[model samples]
Target: MLAAYWRGEITLRKLRVLIQYLPEDSPARWQATDGRPFTIRDAMMWRALWSVATVAQQLAGKDKNAFENMPAYPWSKPLNQNTYGSFGDHTPEEVMDYLDSL
Candidate 1:
């Protein structure tokens, strides 16, 4: 869905509930209460990615003992908060910038 938005296959309003991405100088941009230059679509993508990373961390932590005890070559543990936390460090703007680069 996010890719579709970037491809212009979907409008911001189509993917999101009520938000629209308009020009910075457009009247619609000023009408928003959030005062963000972009629309909810970008926010939603950031939130969704963050939520996924958090859930992944929780699942990894749930089996902490099992992962720690595993005898894998090179002696590395499974994924944990430390591995995924960096993903959450990115702001919505940074996430959108990355997506745009793709």
Candidate 2:
């Protein structure tokens, strides 16, 4: 996954799919200083891939303008927030902070 990001082969839609599997508080959950509460290398990998996907989207001339019209989580709704569980709103900054924490 990291290799894909480094090679800029990811897509925004795919990136969103990856993000859906990451924990809401992945950073705080995986940090060594946070007592290694949970293992989250996979989340970190996806976050890195997301960065690459953003770059790829820009290079392909399908930048923010393309995403602006898309709904949040355009490809699919988060599983945990679907009919089985209550939905929670989170800002992009919060999501990034979680990824960075991991």
Candidate 3:
């Protein structure tokens, strides 16, 4: 997915599908620091993907957007208000470095 983002092939629709279609017990779902699962509303990767997707939509100036009419999870609204804090506040280069270390 990160590779797709860098290659400019990532789309909001795809990201939404990726998030929405994951099985409830899939290990790919993001986790909290203590290893608990994140509520869908508070999923960090979802928020980041949303942020990037919104930016893409604004840049393209499209009348129709991917997320505008999509179904949402029951707990998806009025988000958890940053329960994970801001640990992902790195610049693109910094993020690349962090990813490299993994």
Error of 2 at 66 (Å): 8.1
Q: What's the alpha carbon RMSD for model 2?
A: 21.3
Q: TM-score, each model? A: 0.28, 0.27, 0.28
lDDT of 2: 0.53
Please, what is the whole-model Cα lDDT of each candidate in the order they appear? 0.53, 0.53, 0.57
Which sections of candidate 1 miss by over 4 Å? Answer: 1-36, 62-102
Best by lDDT: 3
Residue pairs clashing in model 1 are none
Q: What is the lDDT of candidate 1?
A: 0.53
Question: How many residue-pair clashes does candidate 2 contain?
Answer: 2
Candidate 3 yields a Cα-based lDDT of 0.57
Q: Cα RMSD to native, each candidate? A: 19.7, 21.3, 19.8
Candidate 3, which ten residues in sequence have the lowest lDDT sum? 69-78
